[model samples]
Target: MKLKLNAISKSFGPVKANSNINLTVDNGEILGLLGENGAGKTTLMNILTGLYKPDSGTILIDNQLKEFQNPREANKSGVGMVHQHFMLVPVFSVTENIILGTEPTTRFNKIDLKTATDKVVKISSEYKLDVDPNALIEKLPVGIQQRVEIIKILLRNAEILIFDEPTAVLTPQEVTEFFEIIKSLKKTGKAIIFITHKLHEVLEICDRINVLRRGKIVGEAFPTKTNNKKLAELMVGRTVKLRTSRRKMEKGKELLKVNNLSILSDKKEPILTNIDLVLHQNEILGIAGVQGNGQTEFIEALTGLRKASTGKIVYFGKECINITPRKIHALGIRHIPEDRQKQGLIGDFSLIENIILNTYYEKDFSNNLKLNWLNAKKEARRIINQYDVRTNSEDISANKLSGGNQQKLLIGREMSRSINLLIASQPTRGVDVGSIEYIHSQIIKARNKGIGVILNSTELEEIIALSDRIIVFYEGKIIAEFPSNSDPKIIGLAMAGVK
Candidate 1:
């Protein structure tokens, strides 16, 4: 299939999401779509997938102009998209989910469960997806869930597959396997669109790269001919400092101490074991690990969201165990949660409301039982301007902003308060390089101002760039520790459980 998007233009009132954009992808090739958050990547893909109509454009598939009124129509036209968030039912079996909308019917007019199962199993084996046909979705790991999504697209006989931020949730090992699957699919003459903010992955897997900035196609380059720096420059429309510059930290008194920490599963199996750490004021301690290595559990326990069966959690040299998250916040511990949509902000709430979600009860925000909307709006606008959130009004719902802007808002909300320690997990996940640089600078600024920071991220480069000391976690235990100057290759090996 040779797919071409010609002079696409889309407008939502005054905001032009995509403007005069042209792109192409051929069979047996991977086309990388590189852009920052809110750069119109989502708009272009939405138009292609039939979720939105392009104000002016023509979609040519094999030289045939096509118009798809809905996703089903697009699917019938051999277009399938895998979203950043997997669209799967937790209770459904793999076969059931894959054959959900397109079920085979028996002669008796009943759904043919056996035939669907067999087909799903065949596809899984062919692609080396290794998914069990009968496994329930909630029980499967993230990587397997992703495979199920791909299998869903393949079952539709899609010649052009659009993967939107497909790797944002994958582990390194799974990432390696995913690249192999893409290669295999390419060999089978499939056209793939890889859309994401990660620059290195573009170089690693893509044949050609297209960069978008502010709703326009700014540049395009071959992976071999262009590097990450050049791609970032084109995507951001400026020189982006890939690494944040930071001064030497002046470590202060111990702000938090954890000893013999352990997170037990429902069956009482140890998720994290014998963890011990000390976080000092004016210091940044980074926890680096692949996904699902007890990092999430550890952070939850520290923030009082999860309880450890055996551990001593102390803050300010006092026991903080059995405390609520609000109490921990009252004690000057702020958390920037990993999953922003689920944990950080209320989607239905305005940006002003979310900004004051945690601080609405303060004396300045309330007088007796009367809450001050005036003060809340004032503070929200201040944070918005201070954090460079890209939004015109604070009255708009949080769901309307881009992911990077949402992150900036959350970080600003967390850091603007009186905080003694900041626990930030995947702080820059899904954000662009420009926002990342700003966020990293804000973190360093907080650390320099005598606030203890615990930075947990899956990106090794981020850990090495920001942390004063780095700890590698594998299977819930610290396997290795290194200074800020440690070689990334060594840390990578340690993260993979190398001795």
Candidate 2:
């Protein structure tokens, strides 16, 4: 027992983020902290890392009571946290960013770049995290930035590491490399607390697993003794069928057609190049790829958020290129944008306002003559009930909801529209176990009802499981297409542009 948390509790107003949470991690062991979004996982980790002060609890480090006032104090106590988003300064060199606060100084208080670079390199080599200390943070890929963060902690000689959703942005190969680094860290006598919603990775890397639900620890198990299905049941409090089941489609006529499409990014490079694809009614076509491979740009072009340089987009047998976003919505197309915070919903608006956002001008929820707040509230309540969006009140602001609930609200709102076609991108990203299952079912239901569906996700399992036909995107080009029943490793290889 290297670290033990006893009866930790925290709350925000009436909402308890964590309640009597008890957890333990042994030295040199990797423990998985499994939970859905807003299940108190992040809050507990923040308390451990000194970002939050627990309302009631005692933290025992080596059986001694300890409290951290801030992150630096936690660092001094041999605990470090790497957040889901990289925190490096883009323009700074790796060494500079690593030693930003804890600078190597002389008598004059000037930064000693040589000493900092030497320490960074030594830590990187010891952890097998090969990074150029002098390279600019922005010039490095996301994986290398992650390595720099880890090296920062190791350079301070941290004995315990906390990683929050570390592989969410990584490619499959990069995920493998990250696992190797984690294994190496464990061998170096460091206790690691791994936090993620990815069950496969938990089974692959963790020795013991802790499941948190509704701000409390619910269950514990050894990975070798339990499977994903069982762990999912414990986390969700129900026996959830993890796989997505879709019937063989009776393909209808084409609903959307893209011919010779090319899109230039703001940097004036071809982010989508000569792409041609079609989605037929009653079928789901999934585009699978690693991040930065042009999937975002492709989705933007189809959703009327970006313009195609030279191409023809025919939605419902009518030309649609260069149309405004409002025009696209009026044409009976519902798009769930990839970045929920930026594009999916208005963070400052109430749930009712967000639910009727694109269609509020219509006569159903509102009219050209007058607005109907009552009907809009009624419709919002319907979506909230149907989508299982857990909230105390629909009057709450959209940004106040958890990530999973926000995603659910977005999906429910879009699916409420009687659209001819639907475009969903990274729809299940950061959602919890139960919400993921429900969202997948809803998408399949929409396809079964004769609406053409275009699915984009970096998760290979999601693409493989939900798509009838899967296309691999590489550098803004469709490299290959495969049936959904193909082996997952095959698609994994395709996503890496190996095929």
lDDT of each: 0.90, 0.88
Off by over 4 Å in 2: 85-97, 100-118, 133-141, 265-268, 346-377, 395-400
Residue-level lDDT of model 1, residues 268-335, one tens digit each, is 98899999999998889999998888999999999999988988999999998768999999998999
Regions of candidate 1 where Cα sits further than 4 Å from its true position = 107-110
Q: Write the per-residue lDDT of candidate 2 for residues 74-121, one digit (tens) a residue.
A: 888888888865678999999999998999897788889998999988
Best model per TM-score: 1
Listed per model in order, the count of residue pairs whose N, CA or C atoms clash below 3 Å is 0, 0
Q: Residue 257 in model 2: shift from native, Å? A: 1.1
User: What count of clashes does model 1 give?
Assistant: 0
Candidate 2 backbone overlaps, count: 0
